[model samples]
Target: MQASGYSFKELLGFDIAVLSELFSSYTTLDATRHNELMLYFEGVNKAWNHPGFTFLYHYQQYVELDAEPYSYTRFFEHYRRKYPKEKGSMKLQHIAGEEMFVDFAGKKLQIVDKHTGEVIAVEVFVAILPCSQYTYIQACRSQKREDMISCCTAALRFYGGSPKGIVSDNLKSAVNRSSRYEADINRSFKDFARHYNCVINPTRSYAPQLFNIKTIYNI
Candidate 1:
């Protein structure tokens, strides 16, 4: 086979540095979709202060002027191969109606009282069924047991069915005491789960991977 005389930069139209920057941006932005990362690259190229620091410009030129198709999917596949460490672990298969994951969003939502004109930061409760990826979100005043139960009830009502188990974070409202082996579920939360014919499975303390619905689905 005859080897092409073109240099690597000539073949790819962009140098390795640009590719490295793109990868850095992908990780920093935490982009879940390939097109979203590509869009960010395009935006950076357009708004870059330094004309020499171009990103995706040559790729777009090749696609538009040279009749080559741009494939973000293929680029991402190659990127994953090149950066194996960035790949996530294998996802566990979930059974339908088996489990629902619930947690409060890390960031609080704000609401302004109409009468008092006071801004109140509220907790955002989220629930997701792993198999179907169905989600329920509600804003509550706090993560108190009553509020948590209320949110869970609303989530169940929204789904119109309860799962076999509810996976919850080790918050005080859900778990009375967190442990590595077996956490203690709060009395009210336990009763709520029992009423729904489901079990409350509290995730171990400091182990967010056990309740990783958000990480899996980018919720």
Candidate 2:
């Protein structure tokens, strides 16, 4: 009933800017969801007369709407996050020759051991540049620690210059624990990183969709 009662308290104790952001960014109805939700809001808009009364009624209607089956709190947080987005600048130490994303995929090829007549399935590793699409590949027994270190050094030499940075997936040999925003780079990898004056960053486990390598020079 009184703006003075709440506004003064909110102004002093709460972040008005944050509250404004929360309210403004709130998605009234997700287009990806049911169309009925949209129609409900539109109906409230046309039916209501007074500004204060309409806003209050619509606010209640929004929460109470039977169409929204899931938790609205979760919906709000979901919309708040730009989940499928690339944020921050890629410090890009190398425009011409700096950083490379190195990784191994699960796919493997069967190698026929000439000496033993044994069928050995070998995993393939690839290091690539996001900008140039240039790639290097090697076949190894598995994605082991030694194999990782060897493959990276060979790939760099194969490319003709030492790259300034290396990006990798949170594989067992590379990362101990994987995080969406950050991951732990292993000790040996850190040594390799320090030797070359390069940085090693593992991709967030949450963001597996972004991982794909293409061979630009060959294609």
Candidate 3:
């Protein structure tokens, strides 16, 4: 919307955080061939008199029937299945020790090998609880499988328990093959998934509105 010179209105109530996240995620997206994506959202917003709540519910409920990719029937069926992310809200809500978001922080920070005094630029690994914003950080090598799994394990122990889901970016260490709905998870990640009794969902290649991927790509 920002790319099209559209402004975010404060009219009609919705979760401020959710709206902000949406804006921040899609603001920089290059328009489609005819700017159809942005145009569609704008039209929907205008029709609803710019009501936030109405726009959200419309997508989750009725707006899809006419559109491609996410047509009405598909949207209804998704809701009917009661998917956690689609059911009540678009955001992931952590149920205590039920989920964790882990990622490799860009712009490697220096972590010296104390024994050798080598200035090793170690990547920062982060884990955040969706519900509390409680997070932890550590330094690692690259986004390699061994490093990532180790970092995630440390994060889980830091949080004191394993969650039912471990949200990760669609990187080599986490995703084995890409897909729109269910991608093949990496072997190491799958092992961790089994050990921790968790499911892994890799972010779509370049889709926005994904809570973590949105910020990750933005950064």
Candidate of highest TM-score? 1
Model 1, position 35, has a per-residue lDDT of 47
Pairs of residues clashing in candidate 2: 98-164
Per-model lDDT? 0.73, 0.67, 0.65
Q: Which has the greatest lDDT?
A: 1
Worst 10 residues of 3 by lDDT: 210-219
By summed lDDT, the worst window of 10 consecutive residues in model 1 runs over: 50-59
Off by over 4 Å in 1: 1-88, 210-219
Listed in order, each prediction's TM-score against the native is 0.62, 0.53, 0.52
lDDT of 3 by residue, 1-219 (tens): 556344556423548786676556555533452245444555544564332234345665434443444555554454444323333555445677667877765456777778999988777777777777778888777888988899988988888888888878777888888888888887878988899888886767676233442222322
Q: What does the lDDT read for residue 80 in candidate 3?
A: 42
lDDT of 2 by residue, 1-219 (tens): 153355655656668686575457667766655455445555654653432233334445567766554455543344335233456645444375667887775456689989999999988888877667677889988899999999998987898877777878778898988987778878998998898788987777867533433212211
Clashing pairs in 3: 64-71, 64-72, 65-72
Clashes of each: 0, 1, 3
Candidates 2 and 3 compared by lDDT, better number: 2
Candidate 1 residues 106-164, lDDT tens each?
76778999999999999989898888888888999999989999999999999999999
Cα error, candidate 2, residue 70 (Å): 47
> Judged by lDDT relative to the true structure, which candidate is superior, 1 or 3?
1
- Report the Cα lDDT for residue 31, model 3: 41
